[model samples]
Target chain A: MSANWRLNVAVLYPELLNLYGDRGNARALERRCQARGIDAEITPVVIGDHWSPDDTDIILVGGGQDREQRRVQSDLHRRGAALRDYIEDDGVVLAVCGGFQLFGQHYRGWDGEIMEGIAIFDAVAAHPGPSIQRCVGNVVAIWEGETVVGFENHGGRTYLNEGQQAFASVVSGFGNNGGDGLEGARRRNAFGTYLHGAVLPKNPRLADRLIALALQRRYGSDAPALSPLDDRAALRAHAEALRAAFSPAESAIGRRFA
Target chain B: MRSLGSGGTALPGLVVERLHDGAAGALAGQLSATALITGTNGKTTSAAMLARILRADDRAVIHNRSGSNLMRGVTASLVEAASLLGTLPRRTTAVFEADEAALSAIAAAAPPSVAVFTNLMRDQLDRYGEIETIARRWTEALGGFPGDATLALNIDDPLIASLESQWSGSSVRYGIEDPDVPPAPEGEIMDAVWDPETQDEFRYTRRYFAQLGRWHTDAGARRPVPQVAADQIDNAEQGVSFTLRFPAGERTLSLPAEGLYSVYNALAAAAAATALGVPPDTICSALESHQAAFGRQEDLLVNQRRVRVLLGKNPSGLNQALRTLQAPGERHHLLILLNDGVADGVDVSWIWDVDWESQAPHCRSVVVGGDRAADMALRLEYAGFPAPRAEVTRDTGEALSRALSGVPEHEQLVILPTYTAMLEVRQRFGRMGASRLWDVA
Candidate 1:
């Protein structure tokens, strides 16, 4: 692919899935790509709208609530074929929280309500019994040898099927669930995790990795060399978030910056 | 019923709950009448507006006036209003603004005569689940409420408007009917766009920053019900003027609160007040004299600097505040505080969803302070706010000092803070012995 090729990105269900500022992941990807001198265009695929990954290189799906999740559940089933095709074609997909759950095999609520997932990743997202507590707070995950810190507020206890790789090991915060101490799932070119909000801003390395992967997939692994910008401020923010995520006292107080 | 100590708000309720968890709802159930105002935002402003109108109509009422909307807060207010004998006086009305999550407990304990459903927005994601989850819970709570209760609904928000028919109650729907913006709410994060009936997305024809929609009631599957509506909003510097349309008649009035959202709040208050038999003139005059709730567009003099405090808890509220600030006038200094406390919804990422680019143009200088001060500064810088950049202080007081020192006396300084941040900031200014919000009757 030419260096000037504008990367076509599809932000699936952006209007509905942008829970807890999960849209920041899209922003981080866009800004990072632009700063690296790569032209990128984002098209939002709202409900009832039609779009395909014909030439799209990256698809981002953020988190949503259970009701919203259910609303999109059937729609996801209809596009199950297209979703599987996109992942099979080596397209990079990033799904957060509810989005992550939907890209899996299926999600089962404690109430026996079953939401069918697209099966982009081999996993099952389940909720604890109705009265069980929710998993919420700033989180730090060990990803690619870097401490990827972000905020996670979700209730899904996603379990990866055997032979599937985990995105990031749980360092702090309830990962996929409190039991496994693991978070997110990675298979092929698709990625799913519970971290929202600061996932991109707090972890520039991971953001760059996603972008780089998209570039490599589109440009036959010979993507243009990327440039780096000063991330001192971003790193400071990440450091503080990581510290806060580990400290129960600080986490309880808030996403502490001081 | 009296200030026994320098105790914090909700302290009494917290203590009573330890002794007895059900004391609050039990005490509230005996009131002559009850009205609950609830949603993601504007509960206090709308509830206070309705409560004031009720008072003007000469109705004996005691409301949860301190902006405490939780179950415990409800219990405390009811406990306070009740006598030592555990019974309220005759003809006493209780109007309370309930937190979204607390609505179920309150509804089960003491079903209201009228419940005003305000527009829901993405707020405190770290605390509350998604907007859809909150909506589902709200629907569940309404199911548990008295069957014949009246629902005051915001039709502009497709989500809330859709609930009118789902509730087995008489409904009064209200919405912004401005010519420029549609009567229904439509924009990013609008949950009502996907029409369930059509099995397709409902594309709004009008341009709306977030407000759009028509007024209609759906009783059940394919069954339409009659409902009242509001529209033709004209926003002015002082506040907003709009025409309120009811089944019997329609009336036009100007509210003293700023922005179209505040106008929506007035309409919500009007709907609830009308259900309680308030005269149109009484509602109008009461609203004209009403003030925005504490830390919500409230004006205060802090350390000799005149400042306006506005609550910026969620993306929608912050967007509206920013839109209002984009007035075709002079630029303003800004002091923004962002906290992720439990009440504030610790998932600090929602700040990213806010349209800070539009806000950057209206801000001449900025001082960001709070638990997430650095994050705010980072966003501002990314939005391309010119340098000699925003002053970042983790300490709220130090942040206020920096902001005051930068602005001249004549200029307006807007301090936008999240929930817990607003509480602490107000406490700082309140300690100076200025007027207090609860001091009002």
Candidate 2:
């Protein structure tokens, strides 16, 4: 076990990319580390700010509204090479919803305008427009043989390229797009998904996985195994989210005739 | 119109619209000038303030002060004021609060002479997608507004303030200028902050709730455009005395409303009233007489105990509500209702954005209710509230009953609920004979 090691998470574009409590995922990662007695610090990567891979272990970004997404997409373009460099050097990255779309090739906007991305993954997302329903609900997925439960709310239909891998299989809700049966994208230590009950507080396992990956990238093989923490409440919350994900009943008012 | 009985705030409008197509516009045209207040958080309060002032000036106001801010709601209020052939009441002015989602349609169909823009905050993400979507949509819609129309805006919100350039009509911008407020304290989670002025990345000198960073334009100057601002504010627990400053002059007035957000609403209403040419003295008096809309810091008695209902439909609103409930050393009997009704925004995940931890310690006993009650209870548990102490249920009536059961007479119970849930909770209070207006609440 490594005697002393600290993990620094660079939450990219937190101010603009926050949607559906995605910031909670960052908090989840922090709490998991605290529960395990691992040293960790979360630094927000707001607009016009830069992060160093040397001090950063994990890069996390969440979803945002379309216009904000475009803004973040532009800022991300400025840091494209730095992000790629961070990933190339083995820094762990986590992106969700709009962030997931932006981390890929690019996203087609609701207006049919093209909003470019950093293309960290060989993928692209397109909003099918307001005519089609936004995939929004509690959704469960099977990831690395465990159930991953969270919430999904997005209009963009993300399609992975030939070589990209899916992060998980949709167990209940819409995955990427409703037709794909797949959710998010994965490659090495970088992960992206639509599961945002902030994705971590309920799916503590994924939070631990990200934390462990950050630790491994920092401490290498000497990283100690994280002690199991009590997650009964989180699991219950996950169960509730899974139940909600399975139910597609729309509110009487929000429902649109599909 | 007086025979709605209860919960029928929007029915008359719907009936009128059904009987006469384009009734919203036809009826609006008959008034001296119509005004529509729209935004995420302060719609009801702002609409109430404006309506009260207009009515105070002997300008009969046709308004929906019952918290129904939809097209049907506004149309119903107008319907009640108009004749069978659609002639509006003489000297009557239409003052309505339009929902953010319904604003574009409302503006396009019946462009009010005075359209006020209250600050936009993250609200009902499931219902609105993102607040920017509504902002962009409003900008496009307003670009086509009648040239005679006047837009009153909140320059404090970067998103709403950014839309000033879109309006070809006359406009007034309003905001809070107190350094003491410190911009409401940024919540645990934030999603928007970029310098609208310089187009440079924005950094907050002091963060506030929802990262409603000091609004700046692309050039990096706060209030770059002239705006009607609250020049000086002296705040208190239950009310505030503020000096309102506009291009014309400054008038100090007091409102019984609580929170900096309520003050922003007052500023917005004041700006709108001034734009409509209502005298400053009249505006001040109306504000003094203004009562907060139901469920907006509304205190009522139920089952012989005092209760306060604070409406919270989204993350920022809920966070602000919780923040207001937190007294340094005081505890509370809290009934939190989370519904996924369309009005409530089905994406319950936004609850995670709320700083429940800050309010957890202040809860003596929590009763979590509504459609998403279980999820809310789980959130409270995760927020560090003792799991065993909180009573959780989906039945609003049962939950409120449980919450109010053992409370002593001295302790006031607090009820915080989402939009639809607020309606349902109020209905339950009505059924239980706990509402002040037992038959109509």
Winner by lDDT: 2
- TM-score of every candidate's chain A: 0.93, 0.92
RMSD of each: 4.2, 3.8
lDDT of 2 by residue, A63-174 (tens): 8777678676667888888888888887898898888888899889778898888888889999888888888766778899999987788888999999899999887777
DockQ of candidate 2 compared with the true complex: 0.53
Give the C-alpha miss distance for residue B368 in model 1, angstroms: 1.2
* Whole-structure CA lDDT of model 2: 0.76
Q: Output the worst ten-in-a-row residue range by lDDT, candidate 1 chain A.
A: A249-258
CAPRI band for model 2: medium
Model 1, A57-111: lDDT tens digits are 8898988767678877777787789879888888888899899999998999988
True contacts kept of 1: 0.60
